[model samples]
Target: MPETYRVAIMGATGAVGTELLDLLAERNFPVEELVLLASPRSVGRELTFKGQSIKVQDINQIDFSDIDLVLASAGGSVSKEWAPKAAAAGAIVVDNSSAFRMDPTVPLIVPEVNPEAVLEHKGIIANPNCTTILMGVALWPLHQYQPIERVVVSTYQSASGAGARAMEEVKQQAQAILRDEKPVTEAFPYPLAFNLFPHNSPLDDRGYCQEEMKMVNETRKIFGVSDLRLSATCVRVPVLRAHSEAINIEFQQPLAVAKALELLHAAPGIKVVEDWDANYFPMPMEASGQDDVLVGRVRTDLSHKCGLELWLSGDQIRKGAALNAVQIAELLVKKQLLKSKTVA
Candidate 1:
């Protein structure tokens, strides 16, 4: 584009939205203007960006025509109504929502896994779900060496996946429980303080919840493997940030643990964080605030000769959502793929 692009962050007050602000400043994205869009309730509230106080604007009242890049972390319903409008108004939208992820027209992207997919975006680019992004970054390196035959994953997701309020709710719930008071439940159906549960998303006829199915479908799209066999079990844990996953991959041929660890160590957007002597691998606490997906526990699976097992922890809000979106924007900038005036 231009010397610098005018960018906007939709749902700018939410957890992911705020992270977007921080990442853009930290990464030094080519920003001429940074607009923050939120709900009417959050209007007039100010958020810091490069030490500048930018007021949150009502999404309904903002004009998108001159905005070149829109980083959308608003909920699905909000993005559903606004993202297209932003794209149609000539801004390329990187949407962090489930609304258009499975849409054949929209390319589901994880910059590390499918940076080429950024070029295929018609107008709006879909950011893969947090759990999907975490697993994809960790698995794609190995999959590149040999095509993965199947994938089995279970997620220990944190409250940050829900949003800012949900994260605070967990803290409040823990406090209320210490006082022997009933924890308030609003952000989630149950108190996520002292307990965990199967993902609260709606379940389908096959019994997989929405969060689980998202991993299954989005990973296939990102990997360009429509028939990729994958299964997921997502759980909400008491952790406030970062997400962890235990993944099992069946490859076409036997892959050694040393080879797997070597691949991960050299892979982009990933860090091999194994400390066997201390019995520590990637933990959510350590993964928090880090840009890289921390991966460790590489070993061969006993059930199958060609199977490999691994574990990963990543900042769900940073690398999982906002960072992935920011990387897509950077890819666009590098490839000269973004347009000043997107024609819908």
Candidate 2:
């Protein structure tokens, strides 16, 4: 019989949290017991998992000693407070937040790009930012063919990246606009309906927002290239889910468009969608709810012989967040790294 383990889904009622629950069942993870954890106010709220109704336990009161794996989709502050505790208690925590991503001791991972990194984790594994995960899944294969000299990317992020409330805000705002009424704001400072804006994350002195910097630094960490050159502009569009990115990559050698397409098609976690006749390429609508990153529009940069350009879209919540975290847990189990072990 397959060895089943106890699994905990932190922040069990949020957008990514809900997806985690569904994925655990859909993927048929070897789960012996499923625990739903949330804030105090959410305590007693029941969530369904694999046809079983599990009540949300207060994070503060739960004992992590018996859990074998924890899929944490809670925000950073929540992760910062509890991830270590869970780890110390012997649960391998796969955190889907920015909390410990850059920590030298933690392995920041995308299973498709760096599954081996899971073996090096002390206790917690950090899932990359949504945009970074999408880009890495699509570009890592190409980078392996030839070292990437530099990368320039601009992201069209969707409202779902902000959270469930933000997604609702976009819908309500759009409806208000259609009715010729004023749109109210809470999740964002500005209206996200019918208008797009630069990512609202805190801005640094370099004028790049925190979201943009995550792409630069996190990509370097995941690729094991400390000196990888990358610049990104993250913008939030009014879409409900999924994210789109335009990528320009400079390589040491000139890689042909046909070769790029061939490589991408052969790569796992990527689906190449292109049709010159229709001028159609990967779009957010098609990429939503997909596990694979939809990639297409392979072309040579007109200016630089060694530069190539491409476009990709992926479901920010699925592939970008929940699915990636689940994949990491799957990797750990497959490698037998989820044995009886505790963080030192």
- Highest lDDT: give the candidate number: 2
Model 1, position 320, has a per-residue lDDT of 93
Each candidate's number of clashing pairs is 0, 0
lDDT of 1 by residue, 18-87 (tens): 8999999999998988999998889999999999999999887778997999999888999999999998
Q: Considering only N, C-alpha and C atoms within 3 Å, which residue pairs clash in candidate 2?
A: none
Q: Lowest summed lDDT over 10 consecutive residues: which window, candidate 1? A: 335-344
- Tens-digit lDDT track for model 2 on 1-344? 77788899998899999999999999999888888998788899999987788999988778999889999988999999999999999899999999999999999999889899998999899999999999999999999998899999999999999999999999999999999999999999999999999999999999999999999999999999999999999999999999999999999999999888889999999999999899999999999899999999999999898999999999999999999999999999899988742321
What is the Cα-based TM-score of model 1? 0.97
What is the lDDT, from 0 to 100, of the residue 254 in candidate 1? 92
Model 1, residue 241: what's the lDDT? 98
TM-score of each: 0.97, 0.98
* Model 2: residue 110 alpha-carbon error in angstroms: 0.7
